[model samples]
Target chain A: MTTAKRDTYTPETLLSVAVRVFNERGYDGTSMEHLSKAAGISKSSIYHHVSGKEELLRRAVSRALDGLFAILEEEHACAGRSVDRLEHVVRRMVEVLIAELPHVTLLLRVRGNTETERWALERRRDFDHRVAELLKAAAADGDVRGDVEVRLATRLVFGMINSIVEWYRPEARGASDREVADAVVRLVFSGLRQG
Target chain B: MTTAKRDTYTPETLLSVAVRVFNERGYDGTSMEHLSKAAGISKSSIYHHVSGKEELLRRAVSRALDGLFAILEEEHACAGRSVDRLEHVVRRMVEVLIAELPHVTLLLRVRGNTETERWALERRRDFDHRVAELLKAAAADGDVRGDVEVRLATRLVFGMINSIVEWYRPEARGASDREVADAVVRLVFSGLRQG
Candidate 1:
């Protein structure tokens, strides 16, 4: 009986395994049996750690959403001139996306299949809207171009920033997070065209 | 039975149905049964048009890839100065992506789960490399900023162009494709910052 003792899986540990499987197989493709097999536990054992597969998804996306929303509250993101604040938010978004890559990857790939995914999507839209407001303010202040529609500008900028999750590999590149952030900021502000 | 033969499905029609289903249920989550129901045909009838689900995926992605590759081969794309060529490519990409919105959407969503998906992914990488070469040429010519790596710039710009498929609704917005392309080109060449 004493030898049977193993480190009990916590929600966080179990979530890590589930997110990996989800990312690999996609959420709809993954089943509880798959999670149990990957976690080296029984289906019943998984229930003890989390309610079900959707809970794992919810938890993962919540972590990514928290990291993103935190950026909006940061001093530089809130206190600077509108364009500068927008730049701060953009750079921070790239950093957070890379830092929470897997979770954010899952968040990005959610297709609104379940209630949890729908909620995640709604929160994501809110985040986008909040950032769009910054762009609008910057435009009103004559910092950003007013000729372009505010919504269009926000979506394109977010597209550039969000796409970082698709190809950025922090472990292999040897590029520091700051380096990635700096590159994103420079490209977004000045674009590819030379002055 | 003869009535069912009134209008036989062509490979192109079948692909439209399959891509719709693939977009609805992530490709891995879709089955032959689902495709049959969506196409209003028997599973055997489905195979008569294409070998299987993978073939449908291959055809759809191929159509999208062909459109993209063709853009690079255009006289304008090939004959202009490096920066001008890059600009034309970007604008044309937005147009092609919009024109082939459904196919490109499916192409973007492929996760390399099958042999066909993997092939599609490889071809997509080849397309990216081709564009990156143009970016490199522009940077070398001093027409584009050299501060960001050509690879990163290519990805970000492609990201901006590709993200169009996610939110663009031609029917709802009453917006023509040319209008959208014009907006994208302006936004890309002119940064959000006001001059």
Candidate 2:
């Protein structure tokens, strides 16, 4: 093998190739042969870095989940008024989602057909509930309108945020990450109606 | 077959069962055997009704697209002020989504794996652009905020609206269709932050 190709073949780099294929063919649809071909490495070589496709899946979701859960640990997420903290979390979520688009997109599409998928789903639910609690607190503080149920509002807003995976192309000449986050926050905090 | 079992089996009824399994198992993972097992009917019986799995997928997405496209043709959608028309379409959309929850859910989850899936995605994009135009008109009339890009706003709003399929359970003691529509309209029109 050439030195340049060999140098670029770390587990992480192989993983980037694996994720792109996985997203394209789908997790279940993808096989080691597919990854092997996509990575330009032998199947045995892929096995050297990871046990199998499941391990790769586990690693990808773990990264995405860690990025999401880390947001809750930040001082801005924990301190300040509930509404302001919620805003901080919302904005950071957009950033994290953009930064880890493929990983999170894969995470969102899991169908719970396997052990790793179920675990990923449970962790996702936990993250959602934590964010929902912030919205609930904001509602209780009367800083957010109480007209809409907090739980429903949280899910819908999340739906809005998470739906970014369906369309936001990091390559597209669309709005930047900060710009999209600003629009989301503005719409979330204030309605689309004329003031 | 018993009279009750005979009564339970129809193309529409069988399609419903197939859609549920298609959602639980990713469409690619699901097989004719899986549908047969889920429906408690033989493979031959299923073929007797709809040809095959692709037919079920086609029917489900067609139903969803039809519901969405019909919204654009409504009198309120066409006759009123741009903002009001958009509001009407948005409200009707939530109702249609709830009414045809499973079908729409299947439509949103499609990954364009086949010719049928690709067509569904194209139709979905067309529907989105049609709504985007309404938002643009509302912006032009100065009835909606001009600060956020209209195309971006349409997508985020759609992301929030389409998200209902993710969590809404017709069986659960959650908000009714009207209540959810009200919340969506309120959030879409006004800011979620307190005045």
Candidate 3:
């Protein structure tokens, strides 16, 4: 992905580099010197682009949170039966996750030790609760199974979707985003046993 | 859980404190000082039990990997039809994850920066491949759906299962291990759509 020739480092470009290192070394583990080395820029130049490492973290997570929150506002997310709407959100989440892979990966790994991390975590919870409500609505409508609690099911479904960040490499010969998303929706609704 | 009266810090007890700190602060970010502080022992005293910070990480991941690999040896995991065996493994994975919550959480988060972390990542991949083969066998039997690639399906299911580390608080008012396992099996094999 980095093969495209680039001459200058924008704050956004610097953030992309910083996010990768943060993911490699934990956010708390990454230092300005590390970011400077990864981005091939000096420490002073990095300060010129963003306030510091915390600002970069805030930007990266904001990008991820924006992607997730946008899914809730889409026409498909709002205009269908609760189950169908939930399915739309799930499928879109996979697409968004892959598209914004690194940012989402960092978002999932945040521990609330710092102020920025705490904020990111709070936003993540709100997104989760929103998804949980959709599941609860589907269960109440009897369009989805009631035997499994909606809250637990929501977390597992998110778990399955989010785990893609750990394993999905864009260059690898894995299934397309849509294919993985379909499997998730199917597995979430059906039993593994052969009929 | 820690509310129970405790006496002295054995290597095992010190390890429990270390793992929690590792999870809270990423492994790379944690210092011997942090471990000492969390363990309530002086740095020199902590060394009396274990070698160093690396020792704690190594011990924690070993415990988690042992639990997972042990499941493959169970009679049910070995003797049943491929699909059933796969189901057995999947169900047991949830149980083991919940049973060794902190250890497994630390295992999943390893990034391979250090030698010990590299070993953990390699073993994690081996365990994943073993589960993938069971999934492949089931797909061959036309037991599990062939629509999704087995590798991707295996990852998504593992993603769902491994995600328990993120939120499966043993003390939380959450679903039982069996409940979570049943939901995973249902989601992995059948899916979310109503019959």
Candidate 4:
């Protein structure tokens, strides 16, 4: 049953609806029927915009990955001292994640159950490895603590940054994204103890 | 399909099998048939051990929650100064999490889609609230920093701890549990920057 609104269903908008459904029902659990219903369109209309749900997933994750990878090319991320650049990247990651919340959330939840998911997983690891290298460089510069291994510190820091998606609601009037990013920087660099 | 090995399938052993399958396939995605096939037993034989998959989920999460709650009742967690007690609870949390990785992993992934999952999520919030209280007390005592809000600090720290399940493998031959816990404690109190 195609409605007159079918004219409004561009591939980008359809991908947005698909990502929300995927986040709710899970990438593995969601079917095209669910996507069509959530999108208020027929399955064939969805197919007309994109090849399948997997293409929608690929598009969604690619958007998130592009946002993240773009941060590394920024001047602050590339030109500062290792620790400073690391901080810039961390702050930008929070901003990017908040700005692209749904897409990144979907990207984070992929479990490599399909070819598209596996590709997303591989890119995620590459992104993580690049960040780990920054941490390692900081350690070598004696700017960061040496007691914790670079790899372990990288994982824990990413863990702290990523877990923001679990509780952050832009509508909640809680901490602003800037405030949250500030708190993360403070905690990651100076920790919770009184100085 | 009930073999002579049916005699070997106690409720606890069967619960273990069910939990592994639930973790892999997700609780909503798993069916009784999946559990039975994974356990190498017939559906009725599996049923003899528990009421259903929900019972298995309840049992698994209860084990994890109990381990965490028990940490609060310990002497170090209860009897020391607030900051010390908070530290004790944090260390024990890492230990308990590593010891009960699969159960807690399953618990962390719960989305409240079912009554059992909703109960688990509620209890998890209760647990988080209790830890937040300790951090509040520590800040009141001037032992912890006051700039970051207690609730936000509690969440960031827990996020770092809870994310341990995503990558930590007991077989990885990387950091030992003690070392990992020590790193977490140091990172929380002192942070990544060098003096």
Candidate 5:
């Protein structure tokens, strides 16, 4: 084995490999050795890029959370009729999810074992609460349904959106991010039942 | 540690603990040592109760699959208008899912890593196909809408229903299984939009 390094792998490239392995074996099941093999680098070389396995996890989840939170700050999400804003946020979320598929997939699968995971879970709840507030505003404006509990509606809507990760294969379908986003928006606003 | 002989744990009881831990720290994340710790038994004792960790997983997922498949065989699911039968199956699925929470939770989380998981996935697909056939029948009868693809509609409906496992905590909710099932049926079929 050549001990001398030639071209160094960027942290982003390393993270791409690590997240793939983490998704395959699961976050907890994956080890440094597994990551090293997947990345085609020495175990010691991995440390040169990331502190360890959990650091990779933290970075991955952080990327996902950042993308999601960014949606709330978008102009369309910020300024519109309450229902329209809610729809925009929902549509944007699907786009971001597909764009950052691996990171978001990792975020959705967190089981809250370590401090970092617990923190991720808390932020996730906060994100849900933020959206729930939007739904409540929409309901108050008489734009959306008011009979169902806001919390329950939010959970169900988010569930439908998040479940896309389970079956959506970007490579196979050749589906553009916008197309998926449009489908999600259309389904969410209009019930499957005929109008 | 007490070296005294103890009564053997039944597969059912052992499976309950295993599914809980599996959900707590994903299927791949858990080990025999974790199971033993959770079960208050030695690792070898656990092996005596069940062949291995994967066997426990198989038993748990099998129980869940059996409950779900049994819904299709029921009188209500079998003998009715196509839409009625579809509704009956959907409602019963929610009930079974809540009643057999832990087992079903394990079933939903399987990632097809082992033979047992692959089998569970295949069975799940069979169940989905059965439901989709019902939806197609309903669409043919002009009861349910045909605007959405039957397959896509089935998946979205299933996604909405299956997500209950992630947040539905029975102990804290105080809602009966029937109540939860009713809510799910109402939300999916009727939707959150007020007329």
Candidate 6:
């Protein structure tokens, strides 16, 4: 009710709260009223920061996509032999996903319900195709297995990576991000079987 | 509605429609009215088969859980060398996931909202624990790498396997169920790298 309390919420802090609510209630289920309640601010105060829930979603998913797309532009991802470059991208992906867990979680769950959601899906497909092309190049280089179809391998590897968002908790005294990235890279390239 | 139209919905057929709607709208978002409309029956007609929407969720998750648990009970999973047994379970997990795609899809998306959802989450944990134990046995046998923690490895492997539900479409011409099962087994055991 106080102006001081209402004015304390920066857009970043508000976005963090909005993303959590969206993740919990689902974007479609979450309303501006829910955001206001969760953020402990007036609905008008929330509108002061962003236009609506869709804008928050756009911000969140764009952040996730940017992190992922940035990996492909990195030096390691670009300069190595196709398989090594693919491995670099995979390792960077785990790091990016863990770093941006809540945002990426929201990104992965968008089911094309709204225009923003559909745009997120389209960007996601573009990211997938970029990685799939990397897998194809690796296969053509005879560095990765050619027996498995490139598209299927790409999807399965992505499945392994993206599933990290489901259970990973940074605050939990579990594996460090480095340990996880190493494990994912090893499992993706070397299998679980002992060498 | 005509009597014949209402009478045509068996519990099995009604459950199918309910699950499809549940997957599309999500379990929490879906209501009895939604199920009734999706099934082309009255809400009372739905109640004739089961108690409510939660019952449909219970039934769907139970079906998915039943398929996964059945994999661990198979002879190959029980009697082989620890690594080989783990491999069998991984392959069968992919198969069960594909065979019961909608059921498992709904199962994976449950967020412990209601008693039924919480129960499903518990059962999923129990299933994960069972698979983790198999991975531990394999690591102890030296058939699989020991550098990665047993629990972490089990999760990543399951992540790779369980993700099949996200994108696998049996009706699609891309890969047969057999091809997918084979690809999963190969990736889990041998990895994406060529020898």
Q: Cα miss at B129, model 1 (Å)?
A: 1.2
iRMS values for every prediction: 1.7, 0.8, 1.8, 0.7, 2.6, 0.9
lDDT of 6 by residue, A50-107 (tens): 9999999999999999999999999999997989999999999999999999999999
Candidate 1 chain B weakest lDDT stretch, 10 residues: B1-10
How many angstroms is residue A159 displaced in model 1 relative to the true structure, after the best TM-score fit? 1.2
Candidate 2 residue-wise lDDT, B2-118, digit = tens: 557756799989988989999888788899999989998889988888878999999988999999999999999999899999999999999999999999999988988899999
Q: How many residue-pair clashes does candidate 2 contain? A: 7
Q: Tell me how large the interface RMSD of candidate 5 is.
A: 2.6
Ranking by lDDT: 4, 2, 6, 3, 1, 5
TM-score of the A-chain for all models:
0.94, 0.96, 0.94, 0.97, 0.94, 0.98
Q: Rank the candidates by TM-score, best first.
A: 4, 6, 1, 2, 3, 5
Alpha-carbon lDDT of model 4 = 0.92
Candidate 5 on B33-120: residue-level lDDT in tens? 8999998878888888888999889888888999999999999999988888998998999899988899998899888888989999
Question: Candidate 2 falls in which docking quality class?
Answer: medium
Worst 10 residues of 3 chain B by lDDT: B1-10
Pairs clashing within candidate 5: none
List the candidate 5 regions with Cα displacement exceeding 4 Å.
Answer: A1-8, A43-45, A50-52, A174-179, B1-5, B8-11, B25-37, B40-56, B174-176
lDDT of candidate 6 vs native?
0.91
What value does DockQ give for candidate 4?
Answer: 0.78
Q: Give fnat (model 3).
A: 0.82
Give the poorly placed runs of model 3, Cα more than 4 Å off: A1-7, B1-9, B42-48, B51-55
**lDDT tens string, model 3, B117-187?**
99999999999999999988887898877667777777778888988887788787778888888887777
TM-scores of all candidate predictions against the true structure: 0.92, 0.90, 0.87, 0.96, 0.86, 0.96
| CA-lDDT, candidates in order | 0.85, 0.91, 0.86, 0.92, 0.84, 0.91
What lDDT tens digits, residue by residue, belong to model 3 across residues A1-195? 342423467887898899999998889889999998898778998888788999999999999999999999999999989998998898889999999999999999898999999999999999999999999998888898776777778888999889899888889886777777777766666645567
For candidate 1, the lDDT comes to: 0.85
lDDT string, candidate 4, B39-132, tens digits: 8889998777788889999999999999999999999998878999999999999999999999999999887889999999999999999999
lDDT of 1 at B54: 92
Tens digits of per-residue lDDT, candidate 4, A1-195, equal 255688878888898899899998898889999998999988998888889989999999999999999999999999979999999999999999999999999999999889999999999999999999999999999999999998899999999999999999999989999989988998898888887
